[model samples]
Target: MDARQTWSSQLTYILAVAGATVGFGATWRFPYLVGQNGGGAYVLTFCIAMIVIGIPMILVENAIGRRLHINSVDAFGGMANGKKINKAWKIVGWMGLCGAFGIMAYYMVIGGWVLNYIYNIIFGNLNLTSVVSADLTASFYDKSIINAPFAISIATLVFVIINFVILVRGAVAGIEKAAKYLMPILFLLMIGMVIRNLTLDGALEGIKFYLTPDFSKISAKLFIDVLGQVFFALSLGFGVMITLSSFVRKDENLVKTSVITGVLNTLIAVVAGFMIFPSLFTFGVAPDSGPSLVFKSLPIVFSHMFAGEFLAVAFFSLLMIAALTTSLPIYEVLITVLEEKFKIKRLKAIFITLGGIFILGNIPSLMATNLLSDVTVFGKNIFDAYDAISATIFFVLTSLLCAIFVGWVLGDEAKKEILFGSNGAHKIINIWFFYIKYIIPFLILVVFVSSFYDNFIK
Candidate 1:
C-alpha cells in the first residue's frame, strides 16, 4: 500500500467532514421528518439524540480511524500498537462500505432531481405563473421530473460523471477543495432562504408550528426515528468519519474535532427547519408532505413569492452543492476500500466504483417512472427500499458494532487517541467512555430491533 495523504490543514479536515455530514439529510429529509413526526416533539428528540448518541459516536469513529491509520476494514482488523485483532471485526467495516455504497446509489438519483430542477427553473420549462396552485406544483414534479425516466436517467448520468471527474483528482485537491468552497456557499444560501421565508406573510404561524413543543406527539417510534436521523445526519457508521479521520494529523485533538463537526452538522439541520417549515405554512401547504416536501411544496411557495424564479434557482443550486459535497465523501469510502484492499490504481478504482453506482442507481431512477414502477423490495419502491435498508439496517447495525468494538475491544487505545492532544480533558473521558460502552450500544440495539419490527413484523 502507498503512504496515505493527510489533510492540508485542520480547518480543511473539519470542513470536509462537516460538508459530508450536513447534506440532504438535513436540507431535504429533516424538515419533512419533523413535519411528519410532529414538529417540536421530533426536534426535541433529535436534539437529545444528538447530545447523547451523535457526538459520542463521532468521537468513537474518529478515534478508531486516527488510532489505526488504515482503511476502514483494516482499521478494525488490527490495533494501534502493531497488534492484530480478530478478523471477525472486519464485518463492521464491510457493513459500513455497503451502507455507503447503498446510500450513494440513491443519493445520486436525488442529486439528479436537484439538477433537473435547476435546469427547468432557469430555462422556464416549469411554466411558472402568478396563479399557480398546489396541484399544479405537484403535477410539475410528478409529470415532468419524477415520472420521466429518460430525463431522470440522463440527469443521473450527468451527476455520476461529475463525481467521477472529482474523485480522480485525489482527496486534498478534490474532496477537500469542494467542501472548503461549497460548504460556505451552502450555509449562505440557506441563511438567505431562511430570511426570505421568515419575511413572508403568515410566516409566524409556521414558525410556531415548527418551534412549539407538543409532548403528546412523542412515542416509542419517534425515539427510534430520531436516533436514525442523527446517525444519517452526522454520517455515523458509514465509514465516512473513520475514513476521513484516517488522514488527520497525529497531534490533532479528536474530541474537539468531533465536537465541532457535530455542532455544525446539528445546527445546519435546525437551520434547514427554519428555511423550509415557515414557507410551507405561509402558503398553507401541509407541513407533513413526506418526501415530496421540497420538490413539490417549495416550488409552489416560490411560484407565489416575489423573485420566485430567482429563489427557485438559488434553492435548488444550494441543494445540488450540498448533495455534491456529501456524495464525494460517500464515494470516497468505496474508492478507498477498493484501492487499499485490491491494490488497484486510483483511476481504475474510480471507474469501477462509478460504473457500479451508475448501474445500481438506475434502478431507483427508472423506478420513479412507469418503466419499473411495479418493482418493490420489502414493500417499498426501489428508491425507498434502498433508503430503508441503508438507514435502518446497515447504518444502525454498523454503528452498534462499532460502539462495542471501540468500547470493549479497543478500550484503552481508543481512549488515548481521543485524549491525545488535549491537556486536562481527562475528567470527562470517563463519562464519554460510559456512554459509548453501555449507553450507545444499548440504544442502537433497541433502534435496530425496533426498525426491523416496524419495517417487517409490525
Candidate 2:
C-alpha cells in the first residue's frame, strides 16, 4: 500500500478523532463543572452553545483536512500553493504544531494519573482509606508527599511509551484499528457507570443538576465557556482533526461525517454526565467538585457506597481507555511533524519525540503540588495554563483560518471541495461559506483578543 494512499471512510475517521476529543475532561468533568457553575443549567447551556458554535468550526476544520490532505504545520502551506505563497498562514500552522507539543507535555501528566489508578487496580490493593486517597491526591501535588511525584512521573512515561508504540506503527494500525476496538469499550464503560450511578440514592439530583437549567445563571460568558468546552472536548484544534482527516476517503460525505462526529461526541459527554451526576448526588457529595472530582471527589463518594470498589475499578478502567485513545492522536501529531520536517523514519521519530516529551513533561510532576505549586497564571495552575493557552491558541486560530480559507482561499472552490462527492448538502454549504467568511472570523478575532487581555491584564 502506498503510504499516501492510506485512508479511512468518514465514519472511522470521525469516530477515531472523536474518541480522542471525548476525553475525561468532558465525561467526568462536565458534571463537576456544572456543579461548580451551580447545577444542571450549565450543562444545559453547554449543549446549545456547543452545537451552534462548535459544530460549524469543526466542519470548517474537516474542509481544511480533506481539501489539503496534510498535517497542521504544512496544511496552510499546501493550501497556499506551497509555503511561500501565503507565508503568514504558515504561522497558524506553527501555532497548531507547537500547541500539540505543549498539550502532550502536560496531557501526559494527567494521563499518568489514569495510569497510576490502572496500576493500583491491577497489582496493588487500592487502599480506600480516605487518608490514603488524600495522601495520593496530595502526592500528585505536594513535594513533601514523596510518593506522589514518583507516581505521576512514572505514569506519564508509561503513557508516553504506549503512545510511541502505537504512532510508530502509523495510521491504519495506530489510529483506525485502535479507534475501531477501543471506542466501543470506552462507551460501554461509560454506559455501565451511568447504570450504576443512577441506581444510587441522590442520583436524580445529579441528573437534574446535569440536565436541568437554572435560567438565571445563564450568562453570556458561561455560554461562551460551554461553546469552547464543547470544541475542546471534541479536540478539534489540537490539529489532530486536520491531520487525521487527511486520511479520509475522497468519496465520503464530509458534512455528514462531521455531523456524525458531533452527535457521537455529544452523546458520550451526556452519557458520562448521567454516569457521574447520579453517583454524585446520591453520595451527598456536592456536585460542584473541581479537580478533586475525578481523583478525590468520586473515590471518597464511592468508598461507603454499594460495590464501590468494583465500580472504582470499572470507572478508572474506562477513564484510562478514553485517555489513552485521546493520547494516541497527540503522539501521532508530534511524531508526524518530526518525520515530515526532518525526513526521519517514523520509528525513529517516535523514540526521539517520546524521549524529548517525556523529559519535558516532568514539569507536571506537580499534578499534586506537594513540592511545587502548578506553574500559576491568573489564578490557574500549570495544567490549566497549558490547557487554556493551547486550547485558546489552536481553536481561536483554526476558527479564523477556516473562515479565511473557505471564504478567500477556496472561495467558489470551497463549495466544490466540501461538496466534492457530497452533492446534496448544498443549503448548508451556502450558509457555511457566509459563516466562515464574514461572521465567524470576526467573532474568533474578538474572542481571541479579549481572552489575552482577560488573562494578562485583569
Per-prediction tally of clashes: 0, 16
The local lDDT score (0 to 100) that residue 330 gets in candidate 2 is 70
Compose the digit string of candidate 1's lDDT tens values, residues 214-321.
999999888878988999999988899999998887788787888898888888999999998888888888999898889988888888888898998999989898
Give the best candidate by lDDT. 1
Provide the global lDDT of candidate 1 against the true structure: 0.86
lDDT of each: 0.86, 0.70
What is the Cα-based TM-score of model 2? 0.90
Model 2 C-alpha lDDT per residue in residues 1-458, reported as the tens digit of each score: 22564555665776687777877657665656776777667777777656766677777777777676666677766543332347677676677666777677777777777667756645644655332354564454333223477767767777777777677678546877778888888878877777777777677777776777788887655655665677568776667777777677677788887778777777777777787777766666656557557766676665756666677778888877787888787777767777776788888888877787777654553453544574576676666777677766666676677568768775776687789768998998998788778887876777677665565556
TM-score of 1: 0.97
Runs of candidate 1 exceeding 4 Å displacement: 80-83
Candidate 2 off by > 4 Å: 79-84, 121-126, 129-147, 362-381
TM-score of each: 0.97, 0.90
**For candidate 2, which ten residues in a row score worst on lDDT?**
137-146
Q: lDDT at 29 for candidate 1? A: 88
